[model samples]
Target: MNTLLLRPDPGHEKFGLGPFFRVEPLGLEYIGAALLAAGYPVTVADLRFRPGATAWVRRTTPRIVGISCLHALEYDRIIATAAEVRRAAPNAFIIVGGHAAASYPAPLEHDLIDAICLDDGEEVLPALAKAIKKGLPLTEVPALRLKTDHGWVTTQPLPERTSLDLIRLPARHLVERHRSGYHCLLFKPVWLVETARGCPHRCSFCSVWQFYGRTCRERSLAAVVEDFATAGDSIFVADDLFWYDPERSMELAAALKKRGVFKRWILVQTRTDLITKRAEVMAAWRPLAKDFDIFLGLEAASDSGLEGITKDSEVTDSVEAVRLARELRYGINGNFLVDHNWGEAEFQELWDFVARHGLQRAGFTVLTPLPGTEFYEGIKARIPDQPWSNFDMHHLLWEPKLGAQRFFELYAETWKRSILNTSGEKSLLDWVRQVKPSQWPYIIRVLWQTQRMMKPDAYMTEHALSRAPLPEPAARQPGAIVRDEGGQP
Candidate 1:
């Protein structure tokens, strides 16, 4: 049986951005490779890179078509693409998987999608492929949900692969040609590598641990180094949580050094607690930084805000990490989530924290209740709209304790104020002029993007006016439930 894997373009145009492309759909590539290895004809098409995606799907008419929905932001595009696929291949089985599908099963139950794969698609896809090839009933396939006679029926859960080493390094050859499109720190061609999967931390707002399990899993050092060698100079380890295991991190660093993979800059994401406790470990792993920068998620500015988000690190640890990164001369990108529970005063405190830490390159996102996360479960009833696209980090989906419009307005203002305040004492344009010649284009683009974002017209036009009232959620009495140190339920 012929199977075609489709990953739809993110439709950046709809989001008011130019056409942006992904290096390759690593998740889809893995599932494709597994199917191919099992002696089935498999073709992978990443519509993000390829133009005329629907036409291409029509041309490559296969018995089954699968699309990966990694981000909630791409929900509209994914569903639309699936509808096109169904039209193109009427008899074809349409399957949707990845983060979005696993998180929000109800969304995928529309007429466009025939089956939804929950959790990891690695083992699930192979079983699905075999079932399709043999004309076996799909209802028997584990880790899959099918539109049945009654309603959506889910099979037994697919076992999560504990041994990362057993899984082949995702089809690197299939992605190698498009490597330049996927860059680290944006704009630069960088290879994306995942040395690990899942997170050990139990942050309430995150769905990663829930999807990939709480225990961290590691890819073999040799396999990682091999992939790194193919990745050329720069590498971005896209692990949900790096540095969860100090020994594994050190071993990987040593392997990179030994294999001469340290030539290009390395970018990684980790928690503040890990960085604070393992400062020496970070120092020891410095060889990995010969070309390495770090990104740490500082969810909120105050401990109360942090506690609300259930981030393991305190505000102090965030400050220390920034200071250490500055001392080490590592490129640091700190990510902060503007909590819905925060009012204007809390927002100012966040900005003050960033200014105080001297963190220049920072990412600020409005807290979104992504499906499958504890955050979503806690606030689903209070969500005014179920529009998946609005769940993108940029938009506010739920009715915040504060007014939603005010929350968004404050968020946009805070970002502008932070950027202008932090990028030297000069004005926005003045800061752009001061940027190095090589970095001029990027800086200008960022400035333009920020200006566009800050414009009152853009904010008012994109977001809904007059906040939609959500169903009143059951109130939680004070001290009704006690949370652990991590604030996880």
Candidate 2:
């Protein structure tokens, strides 16, 4: 039996350009690699890199077509692409998985998608292929949602893979086949690798814990090093919290060094608390630091706002992490969740903090209550809109405690202030200076991109607020309607 794994094109929208704009569909790669390891013929197509995906689908012709829906914004496009694929391959089994599908299985249970993989697809996908090869009904597979006579029938949970080391490195052949015109940051070909799954921290605003569960899982050091070897010059470890285990991180770093994979730069994300407590561990792994960039989620400026989001990392801890990263001479990037509950004063506080710490290469996202998160449940009673696209965190979906217009204005103003701050600019220059002078062109390109993002008028005009009135909570659908075992509805 032949199987084709598809990653739907994430439609053109916010930040859909530059290094950050690249689509690295590691989920589809994981499932495809697993199926291939089991001796099943597999083809993977990332729609983002494919022109006229519907036309490409008509050409591939496979028995089973699996589409990954990584982000909610890609829902409309996925549905349309699935419909087109069904038309081309009438007998094809269309399967949908990923964060969006895992969160909201009920809505996607319609005729467009034949089967939904609820949890990890690495194990389930191979079993699905075997069952198909043997001409067995898909209902026998665990962690699957399929259409029954009545409606959707979901099977018992597929047991999570106990050993992360068992999963193979993603099928690089698939990535290369469709990689002629791909985008990456810094002009270098970039590939994504996963060191672990699930996050140990339970940040209230994040849906990772809800989807992947709370416990952290790590791949064997040898397994991770082997995977890193297959990637390109740059690798992004797409773990929710990369350094959750300092000992494991050090061991992995040493292993990478031993295997010579440390020569390629690696980017990873971690919490502020981890960075502070593990500075020595990070220093021990300094051989890899020149090629390493770390992203920290310092969500809020004030402790009250931090508590609201259940980010236990104190403001002091965040500042310390920034200081430590600078001392260790590592590229540092941060993402801050601007609370809508704050007025001008709070926005000023955030700007002041950023300037004081010289955090230039940072992202400022509006505090959106994304579906399947505790924050979403807490604010369901007062949410103002159903514009799902606005849930992208770039737009303000709720009627802010400070009111909508002011919220947007303050957000725009804060972005401008943070960009123009002298201290922030100097700090970025310090980082650039650490790199070889020959790489200045690439560094300048990224800086230009950052400046474009910082432009107030450009961003405001592009992501402007609609003048429509806010919707009443009573008029909105209940939260349960949009939620399922996998994740958001």
Candidate 3:
């Protein structure tokens, strides 16, 4: 093979991006397709499903080995996996790419990884592969970082992909083992398709705009239709904010419906305000390419909290959006921000909002200052001893305003209220509907992850003692305590 691409596992003991959700490495596959198009033979191995992945890499003697570290949490695993790759094949050119690589390359500038592709690997990966194949000088590849004896050197930033219409479909055939294993929770074997890349909005907590330089380049409707048809039924439109142009989304829906591909359910992420303002879009969604579930970026319940992160929508927009989704019989995954600065009242307020919406899923995230974002440089060193894993959003890196244990307790209680109560009926129904023996593993894994979060200590990746002290249990309200599954309420 000319090049071998691998997606490293994010080393979360209880949960993972792959095994937990069964998501395929869409970006890596896209790069693989572009490389193959350039006459370079490509092989992809998603290490999550490949148990003997190290041995697999050991055997492959490809000229170039490319690995992806898409999330910051995968930093340790990326380094370890790259080190293993080096040990297995010292002669191969090792290139690390993805969002994490571009955001934080200083820590990854080690002896194992030879080069790091800074951004959009579609153009850079193929170019690098072609250069390696022809033994050409590597100076021309855009958005590239090289490790030198003294320090790291970088090339001019690559222009954001202007023509998303030209990129080929991701080579799904490359990782066939991941096909059945890829899914979103109980939604078995879910496929991923993208309508657009990059976001126009400048959310402070997010680095999407910074990574793509505030660009919102979208694929043509025909290209999107083709991609949807390629992915078949049950797709996740992996766009950061799919609500950019309401007319475009409606046009795509019309195309999907006109093609008579109605059985497929798509999951998309978008702002709540879009759903509320564009009622016609939601109306079109019912028959033509209707969304199965929408990841609504309702990042906060309070307008003040929303403003803190530069979110444009008000609290009422989220409420109205959720109401519309419920009326239309669609699931809403309401995402909210959970900060260390929150007290008991704030957690309660968030829980009340979720409960009021009758939302089945509630996603929470700590106010992380992700690298390449406007807030990163300010708070990167605030938590001196925190490992990169803490940045995954489950762990609290800073001292909590309500103290450590109280904050974690509130977190667990609020999560249980959302998970156990908000969607218990649907969960039970899903459990009853599943007939495949293969489905149990996924369901059980999901259950275990959910149950683990009930305990405050489950969030502890490192020493909890390093932060604020846990308050006495006697001081907390009886209702705030997490209930045992088999125990009384």
The number of the candidate with the highest TM-score is 3
Instruction: Report how far off residue 172 is in candidate 3 (Å).
Output: 1.2
State candidate 3's TM-score: 0.90
**Winning candidate number (lDDT):** 3
For model 1, how does the per-residue alpha-carbon lDDT over 430-459 read when each residue is reduced to its tens digit?
Answer: 765654577567656555555554544565
| Candidate 2 off by > 4 Å | 16-19, 178-184, 380-385, 418-469, 472-489
Off by over 4 Å in 3: 13-19, 159-162, 289-291, 420-438, 460-489
Order of quality (TM-score): 3, 1, 2
What is the lDDT of every predicted structure here?
Answer: 0.70, 0.70, 0.73
TM-scores for the candidates: 0.87, 0.86, 0.90
| Candidate 2 structure quality by residue, lDDT tens digits, 1-489 | 788888776663554223344646787788888998899988887777645556666667688889887666566677788888887888888888887788666557778788888887888889888988898887888888887777788987866644677777777777786553443444345677888888867777677887776877888887888888766767667899888888888888878878876546667888888889988777866676346788789887766666656677788888888888778877787888776556567677788888788886677877666666766776655654444555666665545655655666677666665542334445557646755677666666655555554555554554455443554322222221121234222
Whole-model alpha-carbon lDDT for candidate 3: 0.73
After superposition on all CA atoms, how large is the RMSD of candidate 3? Answer: 6.2
lDDT of 2: 0.70
**lDDT rank order:** 3, 2, 1
Residue 44 alpha-carbon offset, candidate 2, angstroms: 0.8
